[model samples]
Target: MQSSSKLFPVALISAELRGDLTEDVYLLKPNNSPDPSVELALTRLGRAGHDGARGVPVVLLHGSFANRRVWYTTGGQGLGAWLARAGFDVWLAEMRGHGLSPRNRLYRDNRVADYARYDLPAIAAFVGEQCAAPAHWLGHAQGGLVLAAALGGGYLAAAQLASLTLCGSQISRLHGVLELPPLIWAARLLLRRREQVVAGWVGPGEGYEEEPAGMVRENLRWFGRFGEGRQDWAAGLVEVTIPVLALAGAADRSAPPAACRQLLERFGSPLREYLCLGRAEGFAEDYGRAAMLLGGNAHNEVWPLLEYWLRHQRLPERR
Candidate 1:
């Protein structure tokens, strides 16, 4: 399959630290398919009126069961826009199934691991090719896992990435949470009626839809099971050495503070930082009202802090 392109008006925001900001939509071709069509969807947000010498490029990766839009709607403050205004090029990625990508009808082949093998590596390589300078990687939830796996596998070259940041993510199998009895029932029902579940989850939207057959089956194969606690691929996180920042939500039942800490602890980086935001942080309160981090409320509260860290690293002499 050949790649296709479409443009959309992504929400943009300006930040206090940088000059101007703007966001754009993008579609990336998949690398592995025999006929490999556009395998990824993304949004590119850039800082206005700044040369590449001003700062490093930043790539934002969204979590599981979510597309790039989640970051924008949730409280990201259009993180891409803010980062761009802050003088950093920003890119937000949508893994195959969640948003603006093609839909998958096959259930037997879906598994979450495909993200690491296909999506994450593809995004990293794409950024390396597009950006004039090394970029920093920011990921939330499963997005973090994909990054870790990519780094572990050597898909993310050190020369191409300045650092890695994870929000509401963990590397320990013990950190996972499932909705329990209800989730179990839901999974069983989904197994029997995958199409209905896919349709319900992927409501009509400008850039949101179902994933492809092989990719969806692969995601389900790994992440399909439901229960109180389940884990896979957490062991790969320990291999990353890039500077890391791990952020968590105090009220997030899915990825609790304790688990997030446990996950961050596995990272051996000397520059690692960890933060946890309370409900009072109002990260999600403004979700859907304005573009925050990427469209995510959690990411919005965390973006400024991340920008501060990135800025400091980029301009150590200022400190």
Candidate 2:
């Protein structure tokens, strides 16, 4: 069995007000095992007095091979900073393998699902505990996939969220066919020569600077066994009726236009809304289509649309 904990230097921004933002690095340690020594430097943001609201909070999760910085560069200060200016607290999460998140030790047996289990759940719990109100959940790409897994596994319930938004998410394995074959080949080659695969992905000598060895191993494992488990989880998309919004970029190769359509069709929420940028919306003129899909550009393009939806949303009575 393995346990994970958050470790990092904490800096206080305000002494009297007790207002601060802390950088948390995480590590997964197996029972009785020597500490792995490497850790993922997970970054999170906290703000107070946002948007006329005293403490509304929103948690943003970044995608694969990316750190939370994408939200700043591509997602633009317009989104996160705007929310903060509007009186909402905002937090961003960097997954284990990317960005500031590093590993606890040099080990070669980690998998992506390890993140699905450890990193994601921990972040969700932390948000639930720390926020003044149930936070709004937003995920992009692989982040979206992780959130879907958490929701399907009963890790996120309506009580834990103000709303759930999936941007460029792949809700069904039916859409993963594009990468299945190559992923299988990669797994086979890794099985035959694990060191070579790890070296290629994790690189050489730059051990401490490289991603967690365990995360590299785990990603391989998840990609190899792809659709074997969780048909029920895939089917459970229909049950996510909590004022959901599904956004897609018209030009996304990973989660193509067809896949986006299928996801919206499968989801059973009456209040659900779908926005396809670069199609009939003429969103391509303002923002590059690719940028729209990769970040929150699509969401920003349709901010007015979301606002209307939000106004109509009948939030459950708070407990």
Candidate 3:
């Protein structure tokens, strides 16, 4: 089916060998989307030894106000690098307007609905084609929201995924009245008066690409609502029987542990599991949204668990 579309997922632009890692970057454009011209960037990482193995692929999706680099930086101090070294075929997806992906024509008006319905499926299809098997997906923070929406909408078919993991992501958690409908609307009001929300300009994070105003408004509405405007999320989740993992941070007020649990409980998958990173859980320290992925001690503490999870998900080969 992917082969028939004019804007199908496979459009390889560059394949370069960088040391022990082989990096292949592709520009994916899904013709099924409202904007077929919207192009997303996907980066695949593998080693020469595993090139013949064709391990079931694992794709990493970053959260809002961030890009693909969040999964790995130049020094290779991120989960994407860690996963590759652990012998998993890794792919990093940069959503529209993030990282190396160029902003779409409707950049200011882009929303998560578009991402869930369009970008997620394309990433899955492309990775599945490259690996010749269903892929496991891990989404962090806002990326988790997008993944849930896609799963709910059935945009990510069950046959396309071996497992699903969500880290530091929930739709119903609200920090305060700051996310109330009134404040949300007000934020959109203020943002519409400008071009986009530049997080670093507004605060003290690294100056990355500004987020679309439409995305902010759409996400703000989800602060207190689960299944944000998704027509198929409830139905799609009811049919998902695959292994599912939802990871939360004990100290994360941004996406509280309880909220993450609520998301898992509401799902119909029987194999659903939850992990909270906290001292009580026998972790070194409580992990926040960022710390769960980028903390100094993640490699030593949580990454091994991630490695184990993916490795265990591999189906036993029949003789």
Best by lDDT: 3
1-319 per-residue lDDT for model 3 (tens digits): 2432243655677787766777878887776677766888898888755678755589999988898888877775588887887778899999998887888888888888889888887777767656777888999988988888888877788778888898988877665565567876777678776657887533354236678888877766666554554464644676777888899988787789998987777677878878888889888899887888888878888787887778785322212
Tens digits of per-residue lDDT, candidate 1, 226-295, equal 1112433344446666788777767555557677787777666677777666545444552221122344
Candidate 2 lDDT, 1-319, residue by residue in tens:
2333233222222222113322233332222223334333333343442223345667777665456664544334534444444445666666544555544343344444455545566565656655567877777766777776666555456567777676676644322333466764555555544422332342222112234444444444454233225534456656776667767767566666566566656555677766665646656433222365334554455543433444445322211
| Stretches of model 2 off by over 4 angstroms after superposition | 1-53, 74-78, 106-112, 171-183, 186-231, 264-268, 285-290, 293-319
**Top TM-score hit:** 3
Residue 129 in model 1: shift from native, Å? 1.3
Clashing pairs in 3: 152-232, 152-233
* TM-score for each candidate, following the candidate numbering: 0.68, 0.67, 0.89
Per-candidate local distance difference test: 0.56, 0.51, 0.78
**Candidate 3, lDDT over the whole model:** 0.78
Preferred candidate (lDDT higher): 1 or 3: 3
Q: How far is candidate 1 from the true structure (C-alpha RMSD, Å)?
A: 7.6
